[model samples]
Target: MTSTILNPYLEGNFAPVPDEVSVGDLPVTGTLPRELNGRYLRVGPNPTGPAATDVNHHWFAAHGMVHGVRLRDGRAEWYRNRFVQGDAPNHSPNTNILAHGGRLLALVEGGRPPVSIAPDLNRMATWDCDGALRGGVTAHPKIDPASGELHSVTYLLRPGSEHLRYVVIDATGKATHTAELPVPGVPLVHDMALTDTRVVVLDLPVTLSMAAAARVASGTPESGGEFPMRWTEEHPSRVGVLPRGGTAEQLRWFDAPRCYVFHVLNAYDNPDGSITMDVCRYDTVFRDEYRGPADVLPALARWTIDPARGTVSEQIMSDHSVEWPRIGPELVGRPHRYGWFGGIGADGLHLSDDVNRVRGGSLEPGPLVKFDTTTGEISTHHFGIGRVTQEPAFVPRPGAEAEDDGWILSVVHDAATDHSELVVLDAADVEADPIARVHLPRRVPFGFHGNWIADNDIGE
Candidate 1:
């Protein structure tokens, strides 16, 4: 199959839309805030057909697709797009889509498990929360804005599996706790960092490449590709911590410096004992190019974990070029000054030489920044020039009180009319312009993480 004409992630704005529409009242331009009712979900990876160009075709292994809208009271209501039905039938739950406790999950980390959608986007099944999850689950789970508990660390790819799993779930959704942590190899533990009392884990140095799983068990082509993972200078890049409900021998690793962190813009518990996180760092990931990801560019570090002098102190705060980071779900696990990101444009931007092959590179992601971690100021909004932006979702305002008082929900993407909008900004004047935009009839390709559930928290 290795020939979708040199693939670049299916072409264009990362193309892959084959129909799943269901529209209604969606077409606003301004005003949409009667305390902004509910639903604004987003989940990416959309490859329901054709994708098998070999080398394991990856844009993070496509096929999840979910793009909601629905606001209320102030209007801008319907607009949907489905396809998340996992548990076989091509299971693809993309990456992230939240709403915990009241259900609505749709994550994807190591492979299959969380899929219970239906706030009108359908697809109801495959949730292991009852069996307390046995296979996979971390699409960035960490919902504990004061014990709404949903934390997760889940990891499983089989083949000698040296351990990883640490769920929590409480706050009425159940799955009280689960532990197992021994690791040394199966790495690629995507994202994790929640603190009120700990659970940080990042084991890094990318792992899992048993010669790409023996070249997909000898069927070789580009040899079972699709991120079988690899970037092991001999492993060991540590940063464990763990101790919220404790176990895994009470963890405490620390070490860190071989860089690679998918996302984690908040984490705290530092009075005098220390433990501050804030990440996006990526000095290396998946290694010197294996068809995709690792051209490098992800800065925004700030790790200071001194488990009694075991050590871990690095700082890079911001030199621009950031990636999906948000705060204010009441600042999950505490302490935050202000944070939001997605900026990355520096010139005509480009990212599809068959989708980031990187030679003559381009991934121009421009504006929507906003960081003032207590006086290092930087605020951006620039949604002009073939625009592209995703991952904002802050939404608070409803009798709010300082700490970035509300609304930032983003979804941009308008490569000169390829379409996709849902803007909204105003999280304390993010350089103004766009207190609302919501027009999305199609073209929402690039995606990975979203949430804004209100409606009194769905469920009923």
Candidate 2:
């Protein structure tokens, strides 16, 4: 038997900060007001079918704070307190969370629930796609800071069926609008992004030919959508931008290269009048069709969505294979920093050939990268190799503080024991060690995305 117990390389004393920025660990609250009890009947695996753990086991993951909006005068305020409201009992198989509109929307991938496709593509726990399945919310809800409105995206599935549909929720936690983004193929919404006026979805449509479906049903990797179907390279996915109000109208749709299975980090307005977005992708398929070994360099593709032309253009950067690029102080001109986990290729981190073979291997946990598109200058601080650092949240300093630098709150994972720690770092210097490390009592499953939720305004 082998063990995985790795520790993050520390520069200064790994001590606690007396007054450092911190968040508390509290159970789901505010769920009572809605007259909702945190209980769900989980579906288990077929007992006569196989001697396996419950296949369709589902449970809530995380709750998000509700965004406060003033409808009378259009006054807007985003939460700053460190508490999560409601109960997120189910973990979205392929969804991310974001604050949008004057509310929060949980956008989810719309498609078939995982099943035992083959020996390699093992049966997904029955609980995998649990939730309000008819309309499973997955994508993160994004808030329009200026208007205080929120937006969310999700896919709807009928009980015991695979017919997928798309739905968007308004700021009030209600699925206000619905639509069917139909194609001959099955499309999944992995990640979504939002600007002040529009929302963009990174969709991957798998064209599982009838021939392929037969093979998967018979149990084989030689089947199920081509190993790498001719993904719409030039236009692999589609972006849907919906207006905040006005009947949740869709502003427009733009075609772009396939996003594969990646999530959009951030989308914000640029001073130069452009919309910037960051994404991570896995361009490989494993022998077991279900799980892909992390392999290759996840490219940090930059797109500038322009309303004038109603299209997105790629932004030239010094390199590719970067994962989780967020807008930060370095992108002050851009108003958002893109950040994500994964290692940088060419760096010493991608040491083992076996690792390189998997989709996300080949590189060490990468340095947090901040690129100023306005000047084309990039600042990077590699947070050591062994620590699997996930997405980062940029916290702006209080009034009269230097806007050039802010605090970055990131989840640091100890790859060895799989333990995670909440780490605070100076936004300006990535190389400088963490300002604080709030060790968690338990290991948090690797999550796709997260954001800050201030607690005070929830009662108001």
Predicted structure with the largest TM-score when compared to the true one: 2
Model 2 reaches what TM-score against the true structure? 0.58
Task: Write down the lDDT of every candidate, Cα atoms only.
Answer: 0.78, 0.40
- What is the clash count of model 1? 6
Q: Could you tell me how far off, in angstroms, the CA of residue 301 lies in candidate 1 after the best superposition?
A: 17
TM-score of 1: 0.32
Residue-wise lDDT of candidate 2 within 411-457, one digit each (tens)? Answer: 55565665555555666776676665545433443334554432221
Best by lDDT: 1
